[model samples]
Target chain A: MMDVKDRYIIDTIIEKCEGVRDPALIILQNVQEILGYVGKEYLEYVSEKSGYPLVELYGIITFYPQFKLNPPGKNTIKVCQGTACHVRGSDRILGTLEELLKISPGETTENRLFSLESVRCLGCCGLAPTIMINKKTYGRVKPSNLKNILAEYEEVDQYVVE
Target chain B: MMKPRVAFFDFASCEGCQLQVINLEESILDLIDAVDIVSFRETMKEHSDEYDIAFIEGSIVRPMDEERLKKIRSNAKFLIALGDCACTGGVNKLRNLLPVDEVVEKAYGDVYDNKYFEVEPAKAIDEVVDVDFYIRGCPIRKDQLLYYVNRFATTPPHKNLDMRFDVVPKEGEVDARSIIQYNPKKCILCRRCHVVCNEVLNVHTIGISQKGNRSIISTPFGVGLEGNKCIFCGQCLVSCPVGAFSEKSDVNKVSAMLKDPSNFVVFVVDPIAITSFIETLPGSDRDMGAEIGKIITALKEMNAKRVMDFTPYTYLSYAAQGEYIRDNRTMTFSSWCPSVQEYLEKFYPEYQRYTHPETSPANFLLKTIKSKYPEENLKIVLVSPCIAYKTSDAFDGVLTSRELSALFKSNEIDLDLYSCKKVDFDKDIEMERTYIRGVRSDYSYARLILEIAYMSKFHNLDVTLNVTPIEDYVYEFAFDSEEGFFSALLIEDMSKLRKYLSKGIEKYNLVEFYPCLHGCISGGGQVLTNSLETIDKRIAMLKEYKGVTDLKNDFISQVIKAYSQLKEVI
Candidate 1:
C-alpha cells in the first residue's frame, strides 16, 4: 500500500504530465526523480492512475539504464573499465573493490554506505585504471589501494558525524 | 484448377504447427490431394524452391533465417504464417529480454563463436515480408489449416484472399488476466493469451515484458503472480494454444484424498459440469443428466463418500442475496463468481462495500455440509469448467471438466461402459427442484438475480433493471429504485471489463464479472475445442434442463428452511 506522501507525489507527477505524449514514461521518470528510485508501490500507484498496465510501466523503467529500481548508496564507486583502463589492469582494481566491499559491481554494500559500479570510461584515460568515489577521483588505482580508499570514505562519514 | 504447390519451412520454433498438419489423421490425404507438397522438412524427404504457396512456421531469429525467409517470400506467390511463432514472434521473443551476446553464450556455450548465423531478435514473418494469410495458434489449428488449404486449392489465384480468420490485433501489448502458469519454454509467443486477456477479457494483467527472444508474457515488474493484480481467471489458459499457459492441476491431491480411508471426501459438481462431461467424454451419447449420473457413479467407484450437484447451494446463495436486498434495499454486488470478487478486490477496491458478503454456492454448500456433519472430516472437491474456482478457499480441490475426463480415462472407467443408473445425493441433502437451466447465457446470471430481486417484492417499487450483455462473456446490470440506484455488472471476459473500468465505472450498485466468456460453460478449464458450434450445443443442452418458475413459493420455502436450519445451528 502506498502512503499519503507517495500518493501525493505520484498525483503531482501525473498532474504535471498532462498533455504529455508518453505519460507513463514521464510519470515514471518524475517519480524516480522525486523518490530516488521507482519502487513497486509507486509503479502500481502510477499504473492505477495512468491506466497503463504495471507490466508496461515496469518495462519502461527497465528499458532505460538511467532509471534505477533500487536507491543508490550514499557513496558510489565507479571503476573505469574502458579499453585504456583494461590495458592498465583495471580488472584487478574492480576485483579488489568487490572483495573489500563484499559487493560486486552494480550492487550496494550491506550497510547501504557504498555502491560499486564499472563504467566504460570516465574520460580520464590519462590516468588509466582510474576509480571515482562520489566527486573525488583516484587515478592509477591498484588492487592494493582499494581497501585504503573505501576506509577513507568511512572515516569521512565518522568525521562528518562528529 | 491446377493444384497449388505448397512448401513448409521453419526457423526458430518447435515445428508444432507443422506437426498439427501431420496429425490431421485421414484428413491429411484430402489436404495432400488439394496441394502439391513440394518441401516439408517434418515428414517429406523431397526439397523444392518452387512453390506457389509457402507455409512458414517459426520466428526469424538469425540473419540466415532472414535471408532464407526473404528467398521463400520472393519465390512463393502467397506466404502464410503457419503458427504463433511465425505469426507473433511467439515464445522465442523471450530472447529479446537479454543481450544477444549473453543469450548466445548461455544457449550455445563456447561454440557460440563458431556460429554461422548472425543472431537477432525473433520476429514474425510479416515483420520481414508480406504475409498473405495467417494460420494462428501455437501449433496452427488442424481444421483451420485444412480449410485454408482447400480454399487456396479451390479458389482462383487472382482473387483476393480473406486474411482476417484468426489474426490478432497488431497493436496494444498487454499481459494475461489470470493466474495461469506461463511456461516460457513451451510458449509459442503467439500472443493469443495476451490478445484474449487484453482484447477479449479487458484485464490488462499480462503483457510482453522485455523485447526480442528475451521477451516473455509476464506480470508487471516480473513479480510473483500472487502479488500482481491478476484475478486468477484462467481465461489465458484456454486462450493459450500451447502449453505455455496452463492451470495448476490438483488431480493428484484429489485422488489421494479420495483413496484415504479416514477422509470423508465430498465431490460437489456445478451444473455446467454436466454439459462439459458429455462433451469431453468420448463416444458418450448420454444426455447432461445421464452423464452427471455416470460421473457420480465413477466418483463413487473412486471412493467418494458423497457426490451431489451444487444447484441447491446456488439457490441458497440467490435466496440469501434476495433477502439481504429486501432488508437493506441497497444495491449489492454478486459474490457468486470468484473471478469477479477478485477483480473487485484488486482493481475496484472502493466498490468492495457494494459486494454481497454471501459466500459462493460452492462455499455455502461446504459450510452447510460441515455444519450438518460436524463429526465427519469433510474434504470438499468441486468439479467444474471454472479454473477460477481453483483459487477459492472453499474447495480442497478444483478440477476442470477436461481434467475430470483425464481422470476417468486414466482409471479406465469408461462412461460408455459404466452402467447409467439414476444417482441420488446423500440422504441428508434434500432433492427439491432440479438444477436451474437456461441461466448459462452471457447475461443470464444477472438476469436471474434480477428475477429473484423482482420476486422478493422489490418489483412493487418502480425498479428499472438494465441488463446488457456487452460482449460474449460480459454483462452489465443496473437497478434503480425510489430509495437508491445501484448497478450489477457481469463481465465474463477481462479485456472488455478492463476497457469499461478504464472509462471509470458509472454509479454501480453491484457488479458481477466472470473471466470466461459465456459463464462457466466455456470456462478456461473446460475441454478445449475450436468450434463455437460445440459451445452452442452445450448451451442448448444446459437450457433443456427445467428451471424453477414458481420462485415465490418453491424458492421461499427452501430459503426459509435453510435459513431456519442455519439459525438453529448458530
Candidate 2:
C-alpha cells in the first residue's frame, strides 16, 4: 500500500477552495484529487481540515462520478458511453479494454499504474465510444486493437521511466 | 433538334429534393437551354400530356403514386429515378420495416376514411416501373442531373445500342433467411453498398449480379463475409435507408480523440474512387480543386496529417500471399479490403488465411508522408465514409462522413467563407492534392482487384470468388448481433438496455437515431447537413476545375509509370 502525502492533499484542498462556495463540492473535488477516489481516508482527511463532518463529506463524494478518494491507478482510462458512441459499438471497446487491462471500472491494476473508469456523454458523441487514458484522447478505437493500444502506451511509459 | 421532353413528379415526400432542384437557379438556366421542360409542377403551371424523360421523386406509398408513376412511365421515353426516395425509398422507407397499415393507422387511423385509401408499402420508382437510370441521394445532385441529361440526350436509343446487360429475371430467389438475420421484413434491396463499393470505393467487393427477384449483392464467390480485407468505414450504414446494411458504431473513439491531445491525428479522405468529397461537403457547384484544397488545408492547418499518404509495404506482403495462392493453385482471398480482413479476423478465424495484400491508396499515401516526417509524432486520421475503415485500427483515427461533419461542427468550419474564396486550381499543391491523387490512382485496391480478377479468369485458375467489399459487409452486419463486435461506447445503464433488446427489435429510436442514421451527418459536430445533392454538385465542380490535374503531376505520372511497369511485369 502506498503512503498518502499530507502537503499534496492540502494543496489540492486549497486548489478546490479557490472559487468554489459549496463545501461539499470542494470536498468532492478534494477527495478525487487526493486519493483519486472518494474513500474513507479522504472523508477522514476532509473532516479534520475543513471541520466538516465525515458523514457530510462521504455523502457528497459518493454521489457524483467526478469525485474519487480511493488509491486509483497511476493511469486512469475513462471511456465515454453516449448515444452516438453507443450505436458505433463503443460497448465492445470498453469490453476489449477491460479484457486487455485485466481490470473492470473503478479498479486499478496490481502495478497501480492503470485504473479503468466509465463516463457518460463526454459531449463529443459524434466521435462515439471515446476512450481517455491519463487524460489523453484516442478516437475511433475498436475492440480488435485494444491490446496494441494499451501496449503502445505501457511500452512508452516504461521506456520513459527506464 | 427537338430537345427531350422532361417532367418532374413528386410522391409521398417533403418536396425538399425538388426544392433543391429549383435552388439550382444558374444550373437550371443551363438545363432549360438543354431540355424541353414539359411539366414541372413545382416551378410551372404548364402541363404536358407527353414527355420523353420523366424525373420521378419521392417513394411510392400512396395508391395515387402507383398509378401516377405508371402513366408517367407510359408517357415518357425514359424514367430517371431522382432523389433517394425515388432510388432507395428514402426516409419513408423506414416505415417499411413496420406494418404499413399499422403505420398509416398510427398517423391517421381515426381522422379520415381509413377504409377508402389504405396506405401501401413504401417503395422506390424502380419497384413500380422500368427505370432507365437512377440519380441517387436524398436530394439528387444538379450536376448528376446534368450528366445524365447531357449523356442520355446525345446517346442513341437502347434498342439500337449494343447493350450486354440482360434485363430478364433470374431463376432462383435468394434464401432470404440466410441474409435476413434480424429480419427487418421490409428489406428492400437498395444495394447502396453495391453502389458505394463499385461506384465510390472502387472496391469491386460487393454488387448485384443476378437479375430481378434473384438479385442480391454478395462477396466475389458468395461466401459468408466473416473476415476478408474490408476495413470497416461505415459509409454503407449512412447510404442505406431501411437498415439493409449497417454496423455497430465506434463513437467512443471519437470521444477519446477529443479528450486526448498527445495522440497524433490524421484523417484519410477517400479519393474520388470511394466517395466524391466535393459532393459530400456543404454547398453545391463550387470549384472542387479549390474546395478539396481548402479541406486539405483546413485539415493540415488542424495538424491532422503529419504524414502524407503512406503505402504499407506489409500489405504488399499480404497481397503477395494472395497472388501466391493463385500461383500455387490454392483458394485465395483478398486481404486488401479492411472489411474482408475484419470478416476473416472475426467470423472466419479458421481462414487465418494470409494474403500478400497490396496497400490501400489511403495507407500508401499517409504512411509515406508520415515516414518522411515525424514518424513518432504521426497519428494518421482517416476521414472516410466507409464503416469498415473504422475496424482497420491502422490509421490513428477513422472518421466517417458523419464523424467528419461532427468534427467540422466542433471547429465551426465556415462553409460560406470556404465557398466564397476564389479557387486557384494551380496552388492546390498546398493541400498535397496532386500527391494524394497520384498515390490513389497508383494504389486503388479495386483496380487491383479487377486486374487480379481478370488475370484469374483469363488464366482459368482455381478461383472461387466470395468478394463482399468491406464497405458492404460492415453495413450488412453492423448493429445486427448481440455481443456484436460493433459495440464501441455504452454507459452501464444504456448497456443494460442494449442487453435487454433483441437484435431484431427496432431498438434504434428514429428521432434520436435519425441524426446518426446517416452516420456523420448526425455526428454532433458535423459542419453541414447530410445532403447527397450538395456533395454531388461539389464533386462536379471539383472535376471541372481540377480536370485531370492530379494525374498530370510529375510525381503522380512517375508513380503511374512505375505501377504500369509493375502491372506489365507481374
Candidate 3:
C-alpha cells in the first residue's frame, strides 16, 4: 500500500531489472534499497514481475542475510566488531544494548525505535569500541553509553507520539 | 511414565505409508513399548480421535480433505506429515498436472456432476495446517519410521533429515508421461535426473526449479511432466538411488484380472526379463530353462490361464524388424523400444512412417491371441524388462520383471520346488521356419537390417554388414556392393541423437535408434540397476541362453503368418 511516488520508484526498479540476468535478485535488491526491506508483498511483486516462482524468490530472501523480509526499525544501531573494536570491548557494549532493547542482534525493538546489528567493520578502526546509530557514530563508546544512545532515539519517538 | 499417544491418518494416498509402520516386524514390539498406538485405520478395526501426536500421511486435495486434516490437527498436540504425499504432495499432485475436469474424467469416468470429487489443487499437510515434522519418502523407510517412534521414549526427535522444504514445495512430479515417478520427499537432490534427462536423453524435461531448501526436481514452471517432451524412457527410474523414481506398477491390476474367473489372463514372459529377474535373485544357477519354468509355474499358481514363452519369438522378432527396416524406402529408425517410438512421434513426426508399431512383437502377440480366441474377456499381460509398454496400454497390463518378482513374492511361489521338471510354455502349434541361427544377442538384429535391406534388393549384391562403432553408443553400418553404398547408423544415446538429427538425418536410408542403451533387455522396467556391468551381464546371459527354451507353437504360427503378410516379397 504505497503512495503514487513510491509506486513509480518501485515500478521503475522492476522495469529496469526485466530481462537482466538474475532479474529476481536484482529487483529484490533495488526494491530493498528504496523501501528499506523486501517484505512479503515485495517478494510476491518481484516474483510476478520477474516470472520466477514464489519458492525461488522466497528462498533467495531467506538464504541471503542482506535481504530482509520485514521492515527495519526507524533507527538502526550497528555495533562494530572490527579487530580494534573487539580489543576495546564492543561485545560488552552490544550485550548492554541487547539487554536494554530486549532484542537480539539483527532484530528490531518492540517499540520499533531501534534495530541492533553487529557488523564486521564500519571502516573506522581508529575510532575503536564504536557504535553507529543511523548516520551518527559514537566513538570510544563504553557499555554504559548504550542506555543514553538508545534513549536519544526513544525521546524523538516519544515526541512524535505526543 | 506417560507414553505419547500416537495415531496414523491417510488422505489422498495408497495407505502404503501407514502399512510401512507395521512392516517394522521385530521392531513393532519396540514401537508399541515407546508410544501408545491409538489410531491406525489401515491396520486396526477401531480408531480414536483422541491422541497426543498424530503421524498423518497423504496430501490435501479437496475441501473435505482440508476439513479432515484440520480436525486431526486440532485433536493432536503434534502433527507430523508421514510420507511424500503429506510432505511434498507426491504422486497425488500428478492429478494436478491435468485440468480438474479432464483428470476427474480420466479417474472417475465422466461423472463430472458428482459432489464427491469437488477437487482442489493438491496441497501438502503444512500448507493446510502446521506440520511439526515429516517422515519422508514414497513410503517412509521402515528404519527411519521406527527411529521416530523410538525417539518418543528415548530422546528428542531428530529434525526431519529427509525433508527441507521450509517453503511450500512445487507440486511434486507428474511421471504420467514418462512412467518414472519423482517424490521430492525421498529426493536427496543428487540432480542425477537432471543429468539423465537434460544431458543424456536430450528431453530437457526434469530439472531443479528452485534452490536450497525450496528446491524440487520438476519440469519447467513446476508443472507436471504430462504434456512435455518426455519420451517415457525410464532412464531416470534406474538412475535414482532412492525409490524417489519408480515405474508405475500394474501388478495389482494383473492380480485382479487373474482372480476374475471370467477374465482369461494370459501371461507373456520375455526371455531377457526372466534372465534379469533370475540374476537378481540369490544363488540362482544360470539355467534359463529351469528359471523360465519357475516363472511359468509361478504365473500358473497366480491363476494365469496360460503362461507363454517368448524366447523363440525373440529370433522371430529379429527377422520381422529386419524386413520392416528393409521395406522402409526412406531414412527411418526401427526399434521395438516404445520410448523410441514415442520420441519419433513427439519430436520427429516426419519419421512417423519409419516407426514400426505393426512389427512390435508384444502388440503382435496380443493381436495374434485375440484373433484366435476372439474373446472380449481375454486379458494379455506382458512380463517384460520394459515399462514403456504401459505408455500404449497395448498389453492389458505391462509388468516389469521387478513387479513380476513382487507378484511372485506376494503369491509365495515355490520356485525351488519346481526346478528342472521339463515344464515349458504352451506349445500346441508347429512352425516349419527356423531362421533362428544363433545370433550373438538382440543387438545382432540391428546388423540384419543392413543385410536384409541391401541383399534382398539386388540378389547379386555381395554385402557383409561391417559394424564399426564410431563412438561408444553410435554404430555406423556400411557395406559396398554391386548396388551403391549401404550406410546405416544405430544410435543408442539420445544426446548424440540430437546432434545427428540436427546435422541432417536424411543421409542414412536405414537408420535405427534404440532409446535405451542396449535396447529392451536393459530397459526401464527390469531388475533395478544402472550398472553397465549388470546390463551386459543380463545381455550375455540372454546370448548364452538364446534358443534354450521354445515359444508356444500357436504363438509361432500367428507370428509367421503376420511376418509373411507384412513383407509379401519374402
Candidate 4:
C-alpha cells in the first residue's frame, strides 16, 4: 500500500503521461523525479493504469542506470573517477571519503545525510580529483582535507535548522 | 548429397532434448540410416567441428556461449534450436530475475572469483545467432523430431527455413513428478499461468516476479512450490502455450515396469482421457468405446497385465458426493477436482470444512486395487487428461493423453491400425442407477451437486448453470432451494475467477473452481488444440459414453459404509 502523497504523485504522473508515446518510460521517470525513487507499488500502479505487465516495466527499470529503486540521501557526494581524475590520485580521495563516511560508493550513510558515489566523470576535468557534495564542488581535494569538508555540511545543517 | 553432416551442440541445459533423439526407440534406426550422426555428446563419444547441419540445445548464458554459438552459425549451413531452452531460453532464464554478479556469487560461493566463464543473462539461441528452425518442447517431442529429420533428409540444404511442416502440436512434457516444472525459455511472457493461478484458481501460488526479459513465472519470492500455497493443480501447465509449464515424465519408469516379468502393471485410464486420446488421433473411425478397447489392446501388447477403465472409481466419487450432501454438510464443495480441492485448502481454508472428505476417484480405485490384490506386485499406471493427478501418490505412474499417443507413435503401434473390439475389465465392478455420466463442461460437477440436492428432497430447486469456452472462462452454477436456498458458482478461467473473488463470494454456499475452462477434458495434459469446435466435438464424444451403471443392492451399503468411515477419518 502506498501513502497518499505517493499515490497522488503517481496519479499526476499517469495523467501527464497521457497521449505520449512510451507512456511506461515517461510515467516511470516522472514518478522517480517526484518521489526520489521508484518503488514496486508505484511500478505496479503504473502497470495497472498503463495496461502493461509489471515484468516488462521491471525490465525497463533495471536496464537503465538512471532509474533508482531506492531513495537517495539528503546529500550526495560524487567523486570523479574519470581518466583525468584517476591521473590526479582520485582513488586516494575516494578511499578517504569511504573511510570517513563509513559507506562504500553507491551506498548511503547510516545517518541518511550523505550518499557516496564514484562516477565515470563529473565533466569537470580542469578540476581533476574533484568531489561534489550537493552542488558544492571542491577541486583538487586531498585525502587529509576530507574531514574538514564533511564538517562544513554538518555545520550548515545546524545553521539552517537554527 | 553426402548425408548432410549433422552435429548436436549444447549450451546451458539439461540436454534432455538431445536425449529425446536417443529415446526415438525403433525409429532411431531410421534416423541413423537417413542422417550421418557426426557429433552427439549424450549418445556418441566422437566429436566433429565440420558439420553442415547443427542442432543446438540450451540457452546462451555466457559471453563464451555467444562466441561458440557464432562459430557454430558460421560453420553449419543450418542451425536448429532444440528443446525449450535453445528455442525460448527455458528454465535457464530464471536466473535473469537477479543481477548476473549476484547469481554467480550465490551459485559459486567463494570460488566465484576463480570462475572462467562470466555469467550473463540467459537468452534464446536466436538472440545471439541466427536460427533456421525450432523443435519446441522442454524436451523436444521425438515424433516431431523424427518428422523434421525426415524432411531434412529429402529437402535441399539451403531452403527457406520458414516453410512450415505439418508437425503434430503435441502437449509438452508429461513426466509424472510431484511438482509442475516451469521452463523459462519457452515462456513467451504470456502471463496466462500467473493469471490462471492467481485469478481463476485463487491459488496465488505463482506470479511473474522480476521485470523485463528476466521476468519469470515462479512462486512468490522465488520459493519452491513445496512451501508455497501451490495445490499442485497444474492449471498453469495447461494455460502455458510453450514448454514453459509442464510435468516431469515418468515414461522411462513406466516402460521399465512394463518390461519386468515380475511386475503386474494395471493401466487404469479415465473415461474422459479416452476421449482426449481419440481426439489426438483425429479422423479415426473408432468411437469412444472402440478407442478405449484399442488403447487397452495397445497397452496389453506392451505387456500390461490388466487394463481397466476409471469409471468404477468415478461412480464411487459420485456416490461419495451424494452421500456427503445427504449427510447435510450445509454447503459441500466437490473434492473430485484436485485443483478445486487445492484451491479450497490453500486460498479458502474457511470452506475446507464444507469440502467432501472422500479421496479422489483415482486414489480410491488404486487403494481398492492395492487392498484387494495385496499379494501381487501391482503397479498402477493412471492414464488421464488431468495433469494434477500426476502429483498424487495413489498411482505408481501417470501418463497424459498426449504422452500415451507419443508412446504409441514412437513404438510404431498405430491406433488406427487396430480394429476395435470389446475389451472387458479384469474385475466386474458394480454401480448404482443413481450414477450420472460426467461431461467435459464446467457445470458437470455442479450438476452433480444439484442432483444430490434433489435426491436429498430439497424441493423447488431453481438451478442456473453457466458453461462457456476456455477463453470465456465463465462457468457459474447457482441453485435456489426451499430449505435455505443453497447456491453455488463455478468459475472456469483465472482472470474472471480473480475478479469474481475480489468482489467477495460470501453469497454462494458452494463454489467449483477449475483452472481450465471446461474442466479436466480441457486439461494441460490433453493434446494442444485451441479450436473451440474441436473441443466441443470431443465433449460431444465424452457425452456419448454411458459410464454410469445400475447399482447392486450391496453397492449402496458399501457407499454408506465408506461415507461413515470417511466421516470418522476426517
Candidate 5:
C-alpha cells in the first residue's frame, strides 16, 4: 500500500461514508488504485474512525462487483458478451480461453497474468466475439487464435496499463 | 451622518448563512464604514431600535416569525431577504412536503418544552413581508451581496427604498404548468452563456441577432433552438430570468435513491462546473471538455470517486442519436437535456404529447456502472445546471450548478494556486491540440450521437460487451436520409467516430449531465462579470504553466487494449 501522509487522510475519507456522501466513493477509488485491494485493515481502520460498522463497509465493498479484495491480475480480460457477440459464438471463444488458461471466470491464472470478467455490450457489437486486453480492443477472434493471444503476454511489456 | 442602521434576523434556517455573512473579513471594515450591524445575535450581543434596512436570512416557518417579520418590515425603511433561505427558502423547504410539526420534531424531538416554538410552513421573507431587491443563492455569494448593497448605496432614496417582493409558489407546491414563464422584457441579454460557450466549450453557436426589442440571444445561424446547433447545455436555462428557462425535475427519484441503501451513490460534475466554485484566473480559458476532465481529476484527487464524467459517453453517443432523430420519422428531443424537455413541455406542450423517455448516454453509463458495480448501497448523483431536473431524481442528487458552487463556499474549500493554473496545451505531446474543442452543450449530445452513428456505419465494425436489456436506444442507431434507410444495423464500421469518440478518454463510474449551452461555466452560479474580466482570468491562468503530458492517451491506450483482449475471450 502507498504510505499515506498521515492516518488522518484515510480516517477523514472513511468518516464521510456513513451519510452516503459521494466523496467517500472517490476516496475508495483512489485507495483501490494505490492499493491493489480494499483490505480488512483499511476497512477496520475506517470503521473505528468513521463510527460506521465494518460490516457496512464490507457490505458496500462486496456490493460493487468492480471492487475486489485481492490484488488484480497483470492483465484483466473483459469478454464482450453484449447482444451481438452472444449470437456470434462468443461463448465458445470464452470456453476455449478459460479451458486453456485452466481458470474459471473471475479467477486469475496461477501466473497472475490474466483475470476474466464480462461487461455490458461495448458499442462495437459489430465486432462480435470481441475481447479487450487492458484498454486495447480486438474484434472477430476465432477460437483457434486463443493460443497466439495468450502468447503475447508471455513477456512483460514496458507499456504501463491503465 | 447617522450610521445606516442594520439589523439581522432569522426565520427558518440553520443560522449558518447568517454566520457566513458575519464571517466576511473585508465586509467587516466596509460594513462598519457604511452601516451599523445592531441586532445580529451571531455577531453582536447588543440589541437595536429603528433600522434603515433589516437583513433577514432563512424562511418564515414559525407563526411567531410572521409577527416578528411584520415588526421589522414596519420598523425598517428597507427589508432584504438575505440568503437563498430568505429568497427561495433553500433546502429547508424540501421538508415542506411533510407536516410542519414533523419537521420541527425531527430536528428537536428530545426538547420537552418545544411547544414554546410554534412553526408553520417555511416561507421566504417575501411570502411573509415585502422584500427589496434581493440577493439569491443558498448561503448567498458575498460578491452578489456586495453588488446589491453597493448598488443600493448609489441609487436615489426613492428607488433604493422601493422594494418589490414577488410571491413565488411555496416550496413543495406542485404546479402542472411545466413551462417557466420567460418575459423577454426582463432579460438584459448579457449573453453570459455565449461567452461561457465560446470561451469554455469552444462551441460558438449561440449568438445575438437583430436589434432593439426584436433582438434576442439565439442559437448559431438563427436556427430553432430545439433543432439546431445548440447542444442543450442548460447554461442559458439557468442564466435566464423572467422564467425564461427551466429544467424538468427528477427530485423524487433522487429521494428514493437516498432512501435505498442498495444503491451506491455517485455524483458527476464536469470541470467547467468547477469554474462556478472558484475565482477564474487570467489567461486560462481551457476547453470545456478538458477543463471538466481536469475538474473530475481534481475531484478524484479530492477523493470523489463517485464524481465522474458524462462528457465522454455524451461525446461518443451524440452522433449516433442525432443521425437517428434526423432520418427517422419519429420526433425525438435530446434525452441528455432536461431543459429541452422543459422547453417542449412548457412552450410546446403539444410536443410533450410525443416526448419519449429515452435515456441519454449519461443515463446509460450510470445504469451500466451501477449494474457492473452493483452497490448494495449506491445512489448516483448528477450535479448539473438543468434545475428543471430538480424534480427528476433520476440519479440521487441533481445538485444545481449553484448548489455545487455553494458546496465550495459551505465547506470553505479554498482554490489552491494549482487550481488557478491555465491550460497547458503544448504539454500534450501526442495530440495536435492540447485544449479540448467541442460544441456547446445544447446539442452536444445530439452531435455526438450523430457522429458515432456515422462512424460505426462507415467502419462496418462493432464492439462486443455484455448486452444488457437496452431500456433505451444505445448509441448505435442512425438514420441515413440520403440512403433512405436507417443505417445503424450491427456492422464492422468504426472509422467515422473512432477519433471523435476517443477525445478525453478516462475511466469513470459516473456520467454527469449539464446539457446547458455550455457546462456550468455558463451556469447561473457563475459570477456574471465582464467578458473581458472572464477572458483575462482564463488568460492569466494559462501563463502559469507550460501544460500537462498526454497521460490521457496513455489511459486510452490501456482501455483499448483491455477491450481488444476481452474480444478473444467473449
Candidate 6:
C-alpha cells in the first residue's frame, strides 16, 4: 500500500529525523500529520526507513492518544464532552451530530466525508458547548446549527471534487 | 437430507491439530457417521473442491498459502480455524518478528524472487478471510471438536463460536512493546499464561494485573522477561492455548546455514524430537522401525552434510556417567535438561559444582567432526533440544522440529517417497554394540545407568539389582555391596528432590532427576506434545534399530576417546 510518493515522503522524514535520539516519536508525529492517519503499511515503511522495529512503532501508535491506527475521514468532527459543555446541552449537540451524520461518536460516515469523535475539552468551556471540524473550532455550538456547520466543510469538499 | 461434506486443509503448520482428529479413536467413527468427509488429506486419499464445513489448520503465510486459503474460504459455507496456528498464526508468526523477504531469501537462497516462495508476515486465517468459527490449541482438544460438530449439525448457523478472542483490544490492553515474546493484543485474559508461569515453572515472571476488561498479563520484572529470573525455557509458549508466546525462530537461520556454500550443516535429531515430529505427521507410519531411517534420509535430502542419529550418541554420556559412578558415590547432575542446570545455577548455586560439565552429545559430535574437517570449513549444527538451547558458540544455531517440518515441506522432501537408507555414523565410531534401554522414561534411564555402573565395577552385566519401592516415579536402588558404589536413586518429582538434597545426595552414587515427565522439548513449544502411546511407539521404533542391551568396552573406547577430546577443549 506504500506507493512511490509515500516511500519518498517517508524516506525524507527518516533522513530529516536521522541521528536524533529516539526519533520514533518525532518521525511518527510528522507522518500522522502528513498521512492523516498512521496505518500499518505506512508504519512498516517508516519503521523500515527509520531503522525502528514494526512492533515498536505499533507500541508508540497505540500508547499515544493522538496517533490513529486507522485512516480518519477527510473531515474529523470533535465534540467536547467536558463538564461545562455537558452541563450546557452538549449531549443534545452530540445526539444532533449523530443523527445528521448517521454515525455515533468514534465512527466515520460510510462515505468517508466526516469522522465523529468525543473530546474531553476544547479549552473554551466558557462558551458552554463547542465542537471542532478539523482545526476550526466553533464556540457555542447549537444543535440546529450543526447542519450549516457541516455545509461549510462540504463546500471545500465540492471544490476538490470538481 | 444430505450429509454436510466436511473437509480439512493445512496452511503454514505441522498439521498436528488435524491429526488430533485422528487421535479421537472410536469417536472418529462417530464424526464420520455425521458428515461426509470428502477432502481430509490426513486420513483419506480422494480430494474434492466440494465441502460444506471446512476445518482449516495452520496459519496463512506465503503468497500461495494466501491464494489457497482464499479459495477454501470461497468454497466452504462454514470455515473453522482448527488450531492455534490457523486461529492465531501459532509459531509461524515468530518469523514475522523479522522481515518476510529476508527470511525467504535466507531460507531458500536463489529462489527468493519466485512468487511461489515469496512470504508475507504470517497471519491467522481470520486476518485473510472471514472465519466463521475458531477452535484453538496447538492441537485442539478432540472432544471439543466433536461437541462443536454435533452442536453445529443440530443448531442454527448463528452460533459463531466463543468469539471473545476476536474482541478488539481495549485501550490499556494493547501493549505492542513486547510483541516479540508476549503480545497482549489477542489476550482474552484467559489467565492460562499466568497460571503456567506461576504454578508450573513456579517462575512468576508474568502475572495478571489491573481489573476487568483492561486487565493485562504484565511482566513482574519491570521492563519485561529481561529483568526476571526467566530461564527462557518456553514453557509458557507451549502452555499458552493461544499462540501468544514464541521463541526467536532459528528455522531461517539453520536453512541459510545449510544453503551457504562455505558451511557444512550437521543435522542432529533427538529421539524425543523425532517422536514428536513423527506423531504430528499426518498418516505417518507410526509402527515401523525404519521411519527414523526415513527421517534421516529426509534430513539428508534437505542438504545436510552428515545426519547423525542422536540416540546412539547418548551412550557417550551414559558411559561417562557410568565410569564416574564406579569411582565415586556422589551424584552427577545432567546438563541435558538446560532448565535443570539453569535452575540449580540460579536458585541453588551451592549445588552447581555437582552439575556435569561436558558439551552435550550434539556439541561432542560437532567438535570431533570439525576437528577431522579442514579448519577453514565452517561447521554448524542444526540440533533439536530436549528442553531449551539458548544460542551460544557451542551450538551455532538450534532448530525446532516444527521448523524442521517447515524446511522439509518447503523442499518437498516426502518421507513416504524415500526408502529407508542405512542410518550413518562418523565411520570412526561404531555405536551398534552399545545398548542402554529404559531411556524413554526417567525410571528406565536411571536403571540403565546403574546397570552400566555395576557392569563396570563388577565386570559383569548379568547382576540382578534391588529396587526399593517408594511413591510413584520415585525409587531407591541398592546392590548387595556395602561400599555403595553402585547404589543409585532416580527421582522425577521436583519437591522430593528438594527433600532428598536435605537428606544428602552422597548416599547414592547417582541421583538422576528429570522434572518434565514428557521431557522439556514438548513444553518448549519446538516439539509437539505426543501421546504416551506415540512417545512409547517412537522409543520402541528406536529400540528396534538402537536396542543392543550391553556395555561393550570396544564401542565405549571409541566414543570415550572422542568425548575426552571434547573435554580437553573445555
Index of the highest-lDDT prediction: 1
Each prediction's RMSD to truth: 15.2, 26.6, 21.8, 17.9, 29.7, 20.8
Native RMSD of candidate 5 (Å): 29.7
lDDT of 3 by residue, B1-570 (tens): 788899998898999888888888898998998998889887888788879889989999999989989999899887888999999899888878788878877878866777778988888888988888887888778877877777766765554344433334445544444566777777878888778776667676677655666576776444465666678777777677776777777878887888888988888887778867886577845587778777787778778888876644453455566555556556656656678888888777977876667666665576566765667798888888777788776678988888888887776665777767657788423343332322222244456545554544554334455668777777777775445556778776666776787877778766667656667766778766678777767766765665333323433344445456534422
Give the residue spans of candidate 2 off by over 4 A: A1-162, B1-236, B242-264, B273-282, B305-332, B343-354, B357-370, B419-557, B560-570
> Lowest summed-lDDT stretch of 10 residues in model 2 chain A?
A153-162
The best-first sequence of candidates by DockQ reads 1, 4, 3, 6, 2, 5
Interface C-alpha RMSD after superposing true interface residues, each candidate, one decimal: 1.7, 29.5, 6.7, 5.4, 25.3, 9.1
Error of 6 at A40 (Å): 35
Give the chain B TM-score achieved by candidate 6. Answer: 0.63
The prediction achieving the highest TM-score against the true structure is 1
Better of 4 and 6 by DockQ: 4
DockQ for each model: 0.42, 0.01, 0.04, 0.06, 0.01, 0.02
TM-score of chain A, predicted model 6, versus the true chain A, to 2 decimals: 0.82
lDDT (0 to 1) per candidate: 0.73, 0.52, 0.72, 0.72, 0.53, 0.69
Model 6 docking grade: incorrect
Categorize the docking of model 3.
Answer: incorrect
Q: How close to the true structure is residue B92 of candidate 5, measured as C-alpha lDDT? A: 70
Of the two candidates 2 and 5, the one with more favorable lDDT, higher being better, is: 5
Point out the higher-scoring one by lDDT: 2 or 6: 6
Q: For candidate 3, what is the TM-score?
A: 0.54
**Model 6, stretches more than 4 Å misplaced?**
A1-162, B1-166, B169-180, B186-189, B214-218, B287-291, B359-363, B412-428, B433-443, B520-526, B530-570
- What is the alpha-carbon lDDT for the whole of candidate 2? 0.52
Those runs of model 1 whose alpha carbons end farther than 4 Å from true positions after fitting are: A1-13, A33-35, A41-53, A75-96, A118-162, B1-184, B187-223, B246-249, B274-291, B371-374, B402-443, B456-511, B527-534, B544-570
